[model samples]
Target: MIIRELITHRWGNKELVTSPSFGTVEKVFVKDDMRVLEWEPLFIIRTENGSLEQIAVGVNGVINSVHVKEGDHVIPGMVMAFIKDDLLDSDIS
Candidate 1:
């Protein structure tokens, strides 16, 4: 996938919002280097008033790495993980 399109919404498209803002890591549902599907929850974040929000993987890819664990603080635009496209020929069929 185009990394530029993944980061910048230049085409009215969707990409993983890696960092919405500094928030506490509430839970992690995915593991490192694992295959994930689009719209799958990768992490749950405790952002406002102890409320939990899920961070989803916007595309199908392998979890290259995880940067934070539960209770860790995150930053804006920080690459929590890296994902490479798992495009199969049949995906378009």
Candidate 2:
């Protein structure tokens, strides 16, 4: 029998982000339709003082879409992109 167990991620397919501090979107290392591994840095945020912070993908998945780019403004709790995992199983909780 063919079996397909769907495992959904905690944040779903959407990758949302919230800037820890007031910063400008600096660089984006990912784009639409890109695949990423868990804990991979997706982008960087730079503050006025030239310090940078990296945003990472918490799960392994494909990038479905990108909502922001370099030089974009980052807001608290904003959706950055959508991601779809490659594997699924009933063990998802």
Candidate 3:
């Protein structure tokens, strides 16, 4: 029998890549449809303290979309992009 979990628990496929800090986006390393590895540097942010912080893609996936551009001000938990996890697709497909 196939056991399925709740929608909130099954966050495998399309996932939102959110910002962990309040800052201005200094740079974006990948564009839409770019494949990325887990922990790969995806964005650089200039924090309110004026320090540069590198944000990494936490999942190995193809970037489905990018919401923020360089110079965009972002707050913590802001959705920066949507990524479709490669491993997640394997299970669904």
TM-score of each: 0.69, 0.70, 0.81
Which has the better lDDT: candidate 1, or candidate 3? 3
How many steric clashes between backbone atoms does each model show? 0, 1, 0
Per-residue accuracy of model 3 over 1-93 as CA lDDT, tens digit each: 111111111244587877777889988998999998877878888888888888775578898889999999999878888888877768563
What lDDT would each prediction earn against the true structure?
0.62, 0.66, 0.76
Query: Lowest lDDT 10-mer window, candidate 2?
Result: 1-10
Best by TM-score: 3
By lDDT rank, best first, the candidates go: 3, 2, 1
Spell out the clash pairs found in candidate 3: none
lDDT of 1 by residue, 1-93 (tens): 111113412112322337565678877877777888877777777764666677775578666667778888887676566665565313676
TM-score of 3: 0.81
Give the better candidate number (2 or 3) by TM-score.
Answer: 3
Cα displacement (angstroms), candidate 3, residue 90, comes to: 1.1
Winning model by lDDT: 3
